[model samples]
Structure formats: C-alpha cells, structure tokens
Target: MATTSPSERLLKTICGSCLILAPAVLLVGGLLHPEETTNAARQFEIIVANLGRWELAHWLIAASMLLMIGAVVGLAHLLHEHRPTEGIIGGATTMVGVMALFAIASAEAAIVPQIGRSGDAQLFASIVTSGGFWVLLGPVLLLPLGLIIMSYGMYRSRVAQTWVAGTVALGSAAFAVSLPTGSPVAFAIGLVLMFVGLARVGWSVLAETDEQWHHPPQMGAQLAG
Candidate 1:
C-alpha cells in the first residue's frame, strides 16, 4: 500500500472544497439582492448574526469568506495549468472571478451594522446598483458563460453525460433572470439548480481523477528504437 502525495492530497482537498462551495456561493450570493424584499437583506444580516447573535454570525460569515477564498484559489489552480478545450480555461477563470466578487459582496453584507440608521439604506442601494454593483455583472454574466464553456469542454473531452454540463448554463441563466424580477425565491431555486449542476461536474471530475491526470513529463528525451 502506497501513501498519497501532498499534491494529490491538496488536489483532493481543493476539489472537496469546491464541491462544498458550489452551493454555498450560490446561497449567500442569492441573498445579496437589494431588489428583493426589504427583509431579504435583513434576513441575511441576521443570518450573518449582525442582528441576533452578533459574535456567532460574524464568525460564521468570516469563515464562509475564508472557505470561499480557498475554493477560488483551488479553482484557479485547477484551471491555470490544465490544457482543457478552448474557452474552458477562460470560462473557469471567469467563474473564479465571479466567485471572488460574490465573496466581496458577501463580506460587505456580513459586516455592516444592522441597526436603525437614517439614509444608510438609500446609500447602500445606490452602491449596490451603481458601477460598483453593476461591475458585479461581470461575474453574474460569466457564471453561465463559464458553465457553457465547461459543458463544451466536457463534450470535447468525450466525457459521459455531457448533458449534465449544460445544467450550469441553464441554472446561471435562470438565476440572472430572477434577479431583476425581484424574486428571491426564484433566485434561490435557480442557485439550487446551479449547485446541482456543479455537483455533477465535481462528481465527474473526482470520479475521473485518475483518468484525467495530466502532469507534465520529466525533462529528458529518449530515442525510440
């Protein structure tokens, strides 16, 4: 019996983290919409414990951010060196960027004071809607874009159940549409679907790890007889 190497362990850890984060990213981000019910933000604030259990929620959100950051780093690494089909790298990188933005927004929402404050709501809304918020559109748009790319990549790689890849694209599109409509429930459902799609991707990747490993060759050339 042989022991696992550090790189292998790290890869597994990263993949595991991504599997866990796929849904969470969607969940926390789903709650950041200002257009949703006023209670939406309030609910998130309370979820983050800014209202009821301050210390507990604060730690929870902080931990969530840390985990997301780690997952993003792992995602970046997984995409950085891999020679996937055209646009797959770009698309996955875009997803990483989106996750980064989502993490930032989550952090902002988590730490802000939840108590009564005049004019703060208006200011927050402006911030969330302006370029700063609109910049979020990059990630928002890229999620589906990346999913489409990943789906295509899987198809090109001749992987089974290619149809599953399409779910990410569909889910992202649904989530995007739900946003402007001011329907948090729809957004949550969309994210749930997106997570399912991601889970499929994760499962496929993990299950096929041995079949997919692509480590570089050692620096030596040998002539064939």
Candidate 2:
C-alpha cells in the first residue's frame, strides 16, 4: 500500500464530509418538499410552524459548512505545498461553491417552515413570483456557475476526470437557463450533473490514493538494466 500524506488525508476528509453533507441536505430538502408550496411566504410559515424539524435541518447543515471550511483550508495547504496556480484557483472556486450552497440552505432553512405551515401552495407561488423568492434565485442559480469554475480548475489540474468536469459545466449552464422555463426534465438533468460531479470528485480522490498505495515503486530496482 502506498503511504498517505497528512495533506492528502486532510483533503480526503474534507471532501468526504462534503460528499456526506451534499446528499444529506438534499434528502432533508426532499423530505420537506411535500410541505413546500409554490408560495414563498407559506414556506416561511412552515418553517416557523415546524420549529423542531427545521432546527434539526439547520444543525445538520453544519456538516456541509464544516466541509467547506475544510476544503478552503486544504486548498491553502495544496497551494503552499505545490505553489500551483491551478490548486489556488480550484480551492477558491470550491470555496465559492460551498459558500453559495450554505447561503441557499440557510435561506431555505429560514423560510421552509413558514411556507410549510401556511398550507397554501398558490399563495406561496404568488409570493415567490412577486420577487419574494428572488433571494433563493441567487444561491440556486449562481451555484452551478461556481461549480463550473471549480470543475474547470479540477480539469486543468487533472485532479478530476475531464468528462465529470465538463458535465458539471454543462449541467450548471443548463440549470441556469432552465430556471425560467421551469422545465422539470432540464432541472432534473442539472441536478444530476451537480450531484454526479460532486460524487465523482470524491470517488476519484479515494481511487487515486488507493492506486498510489498499490503501485508504489520498487526500492533499489534497476531501470531496464
């Protein structure tokens, strides 16, 4: 087995955390979906009404936040270790991606319970249509942009698969454009992209590290002697 470095371990840990949190938050969002009406105000009401559940979601989001912080710190270490521009850029891009997610999650956490309790989908939709949900747009819409940039950095550094990075870029773009059309298929595709990209990055890290362990060079071995 290849010996692992502290820095790599740290990166893996952070990335693993991110991997775990992404799905967890998504799962929570799904659980709350039935409660979320089209109405933004009602969403707020639901959040308020279901304080305990909402609070639990909020606490669960800490995992995501911790992952982001760890990624940022790990990126710094990667930069220091290699002085590579790609590392710096990738790290910063990841920071932005996580930050956007955190913001989105935070906003949703606030308003979900409210709307959930309002029990009026039409009213919620009206509020969202009236720009009440505009705040949600930034985090939802802009996240893919950050992800694309991060993917680009990963592609350039060869830290991740090229196809995965490309998918993230394309998927983000699709989601951004599809928001206005409200196309479920397109939106689903976009979600798939983001989730797949994240998963790929995490899996790649583990695979790369494992490969290193199993393929270490032989000591005092002659080169084609």
Q: Which stretches of candidate 2 lie over 4 Å from their true place?
A: 1-10, 20-94, 115-132, 178-181, 210-225
- Per-model TM-score, in order, reads 0.61, 0.58
Give the distance in Å from residue 28's predicted Cα in candidate 2 to where it truly belongs: 7.1
Candidate RMSDs in Å, in order, are: 8.1, 7.3
lDDT of 2: 0.54
159-213, model 1: which lDDT tens digit per residue? 4244554665576667667654656666777777767766654554454343243
The candidate scoring highest on TM-score is 1
- Model 2: which ten-residue window has the lowest total lDDT? 216-225
TM-score of 1: 0.61
- For each candidate in the order shown, give its overall lDDT on alpha carbons: 0.50, 0.54
Model 2 lDDT per residue over 37-93, tens place: 455555556655776676566545534555545544433332333335645665565
Residue pairs in collision within model 1: none
